[model samples]
Target: MEMNLVIVGLVFVVLGYLVGVKKFTWLLAGYNEKRVKDKNKLALLVGGTFALLGIGIAISGFAGIQQAETIMFVAIGIILLELVYVNVKMVE
Candidate 1:
C-alpha cells in the first residue's frame, strides 16, 4: 500500500508539472484566442485533477487497500469519459 502511494505521488508530481508549468499558460492563452482550438486545457485540468487524486490516494492508501479502489475508480472514470469523447469526435 505504501509503495502504491509512493508511485501515485511520483506520477502526480510529474502531472502537476505538466499542468502547472509545461502546458499551463498555453491553456489560458487558448481562452484568449478567437479561432476554435483543441486546447491542452483539458489535459491541464485532467492532469491537475489526477494529481489531487494521487494525493488523496496516497492519503487513503495509508489507511487500507479498500480506500485505493475508490480513488482508482474516480481516475478511471475520468479517463473513460475522455476516451469516449475522443472516440466520438473521431467518428465525426
Candidate 2:
C-alpha cells in the first residue's frame, strides 16, 4: 500500500472537514476574508474539491494502482481549475 499517499489523503480530508463543515476559513492558504464575495460558497466549493480529491487519492493508494502518478496529475489539474474558478467568480 502507498502509505505516503494515504497519509496525505487523510490530511486533506481533515482539512476539508475543518474548512467546510467547521467553517475554519482561516486554514485556507492565501485567503483574504474581506475579498471573498460569499464565504459559504467559497468554503463549499473548495472543501468539496479537497474532500473528493482526498478520497480519490486514498482509494488509489489502497488499490496500489500503478498509474498513481497519473492520478496525482489529474488531481493537480482539478485543483488548478478550482483555483481559477475561485479567483474569477468568488473573489471580489
Candidate 3:
C-alpha cells in the first residue's frame, strides 16, 4: 500500500490543532471530560509542537527534502508520548 506522506502529515496537523485546542478529548474512550478539560501546559505545548512538526514534515515532503521520513517518525513518537503525557497530567 502506497501512502502519501503529505496526507499523513496533514492528518497529524489536524490532530495537533484539535488536541491543542482541547477538541480531541472526545476521542479518548472512558476518559473523564473534566480531567481532560483541565488546563494542562504540557499537553498544550506538546500539541503545538506536534502541529509545527507536522507542517514542517508536510513542507519537506513536497520539497523533496532529505530525511523527511525521519522527521515524520520523530513526530509520530512525540505524539505517542504526548498521549501518555496528557493522560498522566489529567489524572494528576
Q: What tens-digit string does per-residue lDDT give for candidate 2 at 1-92?
A: 88877887888788889888888999988999999999998998888888988998988888887677788899889989999999999998
Residues 1-92, model 1: lDDT tens digits:
56686577667656666764576534332233333244465555556765676676667666556555566788778757855654454323
Model 1 ranges off by over 4 Å: 24-40, 65-67, 83-92
What TM-score goes with each of the models? 0.54, 0.92, 0.61
TM-score, cand. 2 vs. native: 0.92
Compared with the true structure, all predictions reach lDDT values of 0.59, 0.87, 0.67
- lDDT-based ranking, best first? 2, 3, 1
- Candidate 2: lDDT over CA atoms? 0.87
Better of 2 and 3 by lDDT: 2
Per-model clash counts, in order, read 0, 0, 0
Predicted model with the maximum TM-score = 2
Which 10 consecutive residues of model 1 have the lowest summed lDDT?
27-36
Q: In candidate 3, which residue pairs get closer than 3 Å at backbone N, Cα or C atoms, i.e. clash?
A: none
Question: Which lDDT tens digits does candidate 3 get at residues 1-92?
Answer: 11366776687688778767775645444556565546455446656876787787777778766675677678768768867877776655
